[model samples]
Target: MNVPAYAGPSSVTTRSGDALSLPAPRQDSEFSIERALHERRSVREFGKTALTQDEVSQLLWAAQGITSRDGLRTAPSAGALYPLELYLVVGMVRDLDPGVYRYAPAGHKLMKIIAGDQRHKLASAAHGQDCVADAAAVLVFTAVERRTTRKYGSRGVRYVHIETGHASQNVFLQATALDLGTVVVGAFEDDAVGKVLQLPEGEVPLYLMPLGRP
Candidate 1:
């Protein structure tokens, strides 16, 4: 269960010289898990309200936030080989610039990858799904197969996908708790998504969850 450390640069600068430090995630939530599960639904439509930075932080944290000091995430992984990587396509988040950002789970920060609104392009890649473009933000889950394959061989691919499901479900529950809406989108041209995110080699796109106020 020896997961390798993340290989990307610790941080990246925006055109405005701004760093990607996110608001501290609130540990205490009034929303109960039972309520979250009961209220959770596949919401394809979204309101125009912009999400707050704190909301974004909580959502990311729920998806893959570091829970233990030893670098374990909120979601379980096969052999602790966490192959899933999180990227955000932000559009209308308050106090945060719209751009593509990679989540650093260990550090609880985001690294800017590309700046500008790419939601429209992402929507096109998702077979013209308006939810991808209309939501305030989209969470893209990608996986580096070798992270698990190096240990479990071809069967590792299944492990990676299973892990992503766990993470995506975490987002769904969290969004419900936050009174936001989200839908897990698996219909997309994989290659098209990779190009839109400018993903590095060894990474493959898996799931896209668009989030916003319902």
Candidate 2:
């Protein structure tokens, strides 16, 4: 992982190295969840078209951003004990460093962890899925067990998994609306991913969704 001294421009200024542009917000009349669901498919092959940082921000926001003044997320957590932690495994996203970054849901920002093209390693870790290698970005759904367990006891673990599904669905629909492709990947070595993302012991990988232009 190459961490350049400057490490390029911040995520805000560089929109995939192209001129800064914003994607049109999902309009009530234009973008419908039902429509996106109908159009959603697991796209394994992708064009080399790069995704912008703004696009990533919006996608992450939809996945699990704070939706209220009290730090409630987009998905309902059991007892409001939000346990799901989002991580982005960026590959081809333009203008951003390639690496794993934890998604800070409260502030809606990427906290860079290991930097530089770790996607190839992730691909190998994911049982040699070329999509993991080629994706513009991969969103990892991880959970800190005790966040929910502390509230609901052992059964809280079940609720946490359900919450993760809700978040992943949100990403799927949002990506579909953006005309991007996404596929949910569950087969992988959890320990390997945790090491790659530098997650703590209790933070467990629950799901992986690789995203890119179809």
Candidate 3:
């Protein structure tokens, strides 16, 4: 098994002024995969406390942080053509402004796309699921199909879905390790979600993961 390699701040060279630099992800953890898997559950109830930036960083890192110098991420992609994009709907994170932010795994940083908390709107878009509104932060997963389909043709669509499962599961396990509650939510209107994130054309929303202290 290829584990996620940690690339500290010293290794991150490309970053824009607007992007918030993330803390280095710790590879060593007392929690083991077997334990995380045994304990992993779909968490809907969450605490009102705000999440720390380090927790946010670890979660995002598990989802899609680059694990190697060649840009190989925590999750594998078909043909190494990563089509997935991660967006965060920030609500109650410490020291972080509430807004819509995009995660760039290459630099392990967040770029603000929209200002203010939009979690309520997102919950509405998610068919009024309270979990979406209650979590301190929600990670929205999107994909540009053409990145994979352009090469694999019709079958590439399946590859995108498989990649999504891989990425989402990583978050689940990482959440368990951090003692955070998270659940993968897929029941939502496509158009509504795209609008909530103001996603670009061709980027399809695949999953909504609301995360916070249980």
The best candidate by lDDT is: 3
Which candidate tops TM-score?
3
Better of 1 and 3 by TM-score: 3
What's the true lDDT of residue 86 in model 1? Answer: 94
- Winner by TM-score between candidate 3 and candidate 2: 3
lDDT score, candidate 3, position 44: 99
Q: Model 1 off-target regions past 4 Å? A: 1-19
lDDT head-to-head 2 vs 3, winner:
3
lDDT of 1 by residue, 14-94 (tens): 323334777788877788899998988999998777777788999999999999978888999989888999999988887
> For every model shown, what is its TM-score relative to the native structure?
0.91, 0.86, 0.92
| Tens-digit lDDT track of model 2 for 1-214 | 2222333334543233222333333324477878998998888887666676766877888888887799988788888888888888887665776778787775456677777777777777788899888887898999998988987899998999899889888888888888888899898888887877888888999888888888
Query: How well does candidate 3 match the true structure in TM-score terms?
Result: 0.92
All candidates: CA RMSD (Å): 8.0, 6.2, 6.5
Q: Global CA lDDT of candidate 1, please?
A: 0.88
